[model samples]
Target: MTRDNGFSRRNVLRSAAALAGVGGLGGVATASDGESLRQIGPADLSDVPTDLEAVPAAAVPETSSGIGPGSMLFITPPGGGEAACTANFVWTDDSGTTYLGAAGHCFLGSSAAGGTELDEGPDLADVEVRVCVDCQFGGLSALVGGLRGEVVELGDVVYARQRTDDGTEVGFDFGLVEVPSSAEGLIDPSMPTWDGPSETGEINAGDTVVQYGNGVVTGETVLTKSRAGSGTGNDDASGSWTAALLAAPGDSGSAVQVGELGAGGLTGVEAAGILTHVGTSGTAGTNLQKAKEMATEAGLSIEVVLAG
Candidate 1:
């Protein structure tokens, strides 16, 4: 695996340009999530990568771009400076409706344990979608995600991109959905069920963390995590003690699991940690209660919690 230093503005910019752009952070939501006092939208929204940097910030909507499977991506108005990390593209639901998901903390730019709160959860919207300048093809993960994970930008104009096997940065346009919040199902949790008591564990920077995404019935895709320090939350309950994984920006909110049958259930949720000098690396988040809360806010149900 490649060791990410996180200080490469040049490299980040290069990746951003290659992406035209792409998508971090945390105060995790436990029983004590939001208070409804926080206002959603701009003034807090910052651009995604350093490259597709936006000028004045804007409000985030509760929607995902029509395109999927790219290195986390977003677009600005024509040339609204650059794009900001709208939110993490948590995965999609049935019927192919791409859900624009993010941590309650990222959606809520406020103060918290150890996470960095930015955009608001209610600000999601299915805006327009933009494709990579001259890119095509998707990867195994992207293809499964319904989202294209190629490198992307926050602002307009294809600048550069991070490294990828495809050798091309992919961009996407928003299909524009008119949903209020897809986080409802989680609060209830009975939407549907995947087979797995599963479980949650931790990994260090050197250790390889693995899990399954996409969906339950489909298949398990194994990817390694770089293991950042404490996740978005400050307390030990937030994450386990792991070195730092090369967990990238697009990886926040991913479910960590053991390499067993069916991604071996789950270990913990991945979060984009607070960066000191090093770059993003990754976060080791546990606390299933917090995950359940997040799922509730997003309107998704926790089919199962992989208890360790």
Candidate 2:
């Protein structure tokens, strides 16, 4: 794999142009409020092992009252610029430490798309994570103070021969932001519009899904069975899932939920994946099950805690 140092504005523009030509499906959700939060670039494969055993699903309470998956999170990198992304879920380690998962690229100072720069480990001292209440796309809302903590771990970038229609290889990009003890009572593990306590389930090519991100209003879409392996570079086509959900730049790391569509509404919805890439055809996500295993290998005993 070829590694590129920092991604230039030119590269992001090129990516945007490329995406526009392909019908603008893979672009990161852009903040409608004139914010310039750039999506972090993909990474190259490293020695990180991918064969770790699946961490058993944890028991979720009957309900939760903290922030849900679709909530918007403001990530301020160590360098001082602020970017936004969707929070995946409220997670907890065996010792009861809380965390929120976002895209790993959100914290990188340079591109690791084809190199080992990440081996040196990114710094997290001045990094800050925050949540906004009543915030909408392109609009402002009240801040919930900083959910102070550092990025305790990052998901390894797994190399897969699989390439997307554009020939970009699939990658697993996720990061764990440790939550300060003071903010634990403020997060809710349930999704806003779905059932409580997201359960782990495999998503198929034709499954209906719902996603929540700060970039789009009403983030729901259907998976086109035909795009499963047609060249989206999604890792494990059988396990990964995508949809026509409208994602913008700041929407990275949004939670993708698996659900049943009906006249009444979505039913049996559960957390299935986290949005990582946006394409003209749809948005790609890493399977939640795989994310769990990756976290385990990183030496963090974590689980997606759900609402009761």
Candidate 3:
């Protein structure tokens, strides 16, 4: 794995991208029996509230320019310039409010700039979600190659969870941005390239996992940006799971699914978690089931916007 001296969140993301190509986190965990942990199991979300508008077993209309999972998003930190991150999943509440998922850290300013510390969360009122057009095609060159795209103000942030409450138990490092009604038509709940997070799924040690990350450094090329790896297991009881999938700095908040690859892309996928942080051994994600529970506790009462 490639190593970098910098520990800032930005550099940490880039390092993860580099690790993707060379067999990530060489020592990621495996099952105790040394056998595959892959299994067909569904998460128990029968009690969770779902979107009132979702049609069961219906097809999700494809949108060429819609903003959804895999879209590039930017937000300005308190004292710093704009930073980029990927959207994880789409969510909705009974009141008909559409919310986009992202890492809580994406809304925070760097510690060096006198912003909230990396360990702490940002104030929801202070965050603004900006969706970027034409960013995927140009990558970083878009900024200097004169191919820059405009950033559209989507809406204000609704919630950003503090990583920890009492500094002992870890909290879910997730955030949600409200997508206004005027721009709701631009929303596409499906993931790019590899589709179908058919439903919430479970993650176990050694399970095969696939992800498509939109880190600026990885460019938007499907073949390069999409990755397949195996699950390492839960990092702890904090509603977090670990995996060795390919990722980069801007890939934070990208969705990960428990699935297998087929001729087309992913087949039989179950939305498992949202990418949050990276470690020396693997990447950590907020389990989707747990994220929903946390959102419910915060009075959001949301359901994952599903793909047909």
Q: lDDT for each of the candidates?
A: 0.25, 0.47, 0.57
Model 3 bad stretches (over 4 Å):
1-64, 110-123, 133-135, 142-150, 166-171, 261-265
| Positional deviation of residue 18's Cα in model 2 after best superposition, in angstroms | 9.7
Q: Per-residue lDDT tens digits of candidate 3, residues 1-308?
A: 01111224543344444444322211222223232211100111112222212112222223213677766676654443445577878899899889888876566543211112323344546665676443333233322222323345778777665345333112255778888887787777777666767787766788888776655446444455567778987643567777876565567777888887778755537888888655555566688877787777677788888887
Among all windows of ten consecutive residues in candidate 3, which has the lowest summed lDDT?
37-46
190 Cα displacement, candidate 3 (Å): 0.8
TM-score of each: 0.33, 0.62, 0.71
- Runs of candidate 2 with Cα error greater than 4 angstroms are 1-66, 112-120, 136-169, 216-239, 262-264
lDDT: worst 10-residue window of model 2: 220-229
TM-score, cand. 2: 0.62
The model with the greater lDDT, 1 or 3, is 3
Candidate 2, residues 14-68, lDDT tens digits: the string is: 3344334332222333222222222322211121122212111232122212355
User: Would you list the clashing residue pairs of candidate 3?
Assistant: 13-249
lDDT of 1 by residue, 1-308 (tens): 01111223443343333222121222222111221111111111122223222111122111111222211223332223222222222333344333433222222223221111113222332232222211121121222222222232221111111111231101100112212243223211110112122333333334334422221111112222112123222233432222233333333323333222235542233321211111223323323334333344435443231222
